[model samples]
Target: MSLEAEIRRLRELDWRELDIKEAGVWPWSLQLICCLLLFLGIFLGMHWYLVSPAKQELQRMREQEVELVREFRSKSLRAANLDTVRGQMEELEARMEALQEMLPTGAEVPSLIDSISEAAIDNQLSIDFIRLRSPSSQEHFIERPFDLQVRGDYHRLASFVADVASLSRIVTLHDFTLEPGSGGVRDLRLSLLARTYSYRHDGGGT
Candidate 1:
């Protein structure tokens, strides 16, 4: 058969039998629109409910990691500064120990007399007179010595001065005077010098 004849026969035979529904008219068009809307709704729902929150959580974790790194570096620098100060303190302590070892050992006597007077007052002794005098010069030892004059009843004065000599700071008495009392007893008059030494750390005279 010729091509023109075949075309004519195909066009004439199927006009009514092959007719399909029109896609642009009411029901069919509405169904296609509804399908498109359903797909769009599913995509938007997943993005709002699931994917967006996950992305926000990932960003928060990244920010926290950066802050922690900065804090760690600051703490490390402070630790290094503390170590340097500790080294300097140790050196100063060593120098203080050496100076203390070279100094002479002696007593603080004025402090001892003060302690004795305090004890005598606490013990209810009636002190009539108290005096302190300048120390005597001595060539043998480096010391600052002073004399104490005390007047009281015999027993109270003896006990007070004896207690003063027994103190830890090392006091030595050189002389004392006593007078006779009226009731077959003696009133005490004490004149005694006590000595102590102090060392100068700054190379000044002692």
Candidate 2:
């Protein structure tokens, strides 16, 4: 039929006369409208139940992929510099071992004091006293201190300090004091604290 005829038939149809049992006899326009509505409902239902969740899952997976890529790049950069980092670590360890050698062991401290005395004698400084103080425990080493007093000329006293510093073991001088001695005008008395260290082995000072 023509479009105008269909429209006129739909407009002339009776109101409140439609029934399900009489659907087979309904106008063609009504049936077409119902079919279109049914198709639209089915499409909306499918999108809500199936396609929406799948889209959400796909979006989540994409975000996860981005994070994984970032992590991979960071790890790759570290891997590329692995050899250089290892070499630096090894060099540091070697220097640490060398420094540990400079620190004397507990048993060698007496000999270290003897070396100090020899330095004083070599510099023509009179050894007034060279007494050991109580040892102090540190986190990774033991600090052994010596209270030293000597009498000499100014030049000799400076020489003795330099000699003590040049010893094979690490000996640090602290708290130095100088005063006039009773002997003569050029006489000088030197008093100082000398500190030595020993490495702690097996969590104990050696």
What's the lDDT for residue 25 in model 2?
80
lDDT string, candidate 1, 1-206, tens digits: 57676557655644455333643432433446567898899999999999999999999989998999898888888787987878888888898666454333434444555676786785455454445455433454355566566656767777877776666554566766666544345455556665554455544444
Q: List the pairs of residues colliding in candidate 1.
A: none
Q: Which regions of candidate 2 fall more than 4 Å away from where they truly are?
A: 1-49
**lDDT minimum window of 10 residues, candidate 2:** 197-206
- 52: Cα error in model 1, Å: 99
Query: Could you tell me every candidate's TM-score relative to the true structure?
Result: 0.37, 0.75
Q: List model 2 lDDT by residue over 1-206, tens digit each.
A: 88889899889988588887887887788889988999999999999999999999999999999999999999999999999999999999999999999999989999999999899999988999999988999899999999999999999999999999999999999999999999898899999999999999777754
The clash number for model 2 is: 0
Q: Give the Cα lDDT of each candidate.
A: 0.62, 0.93
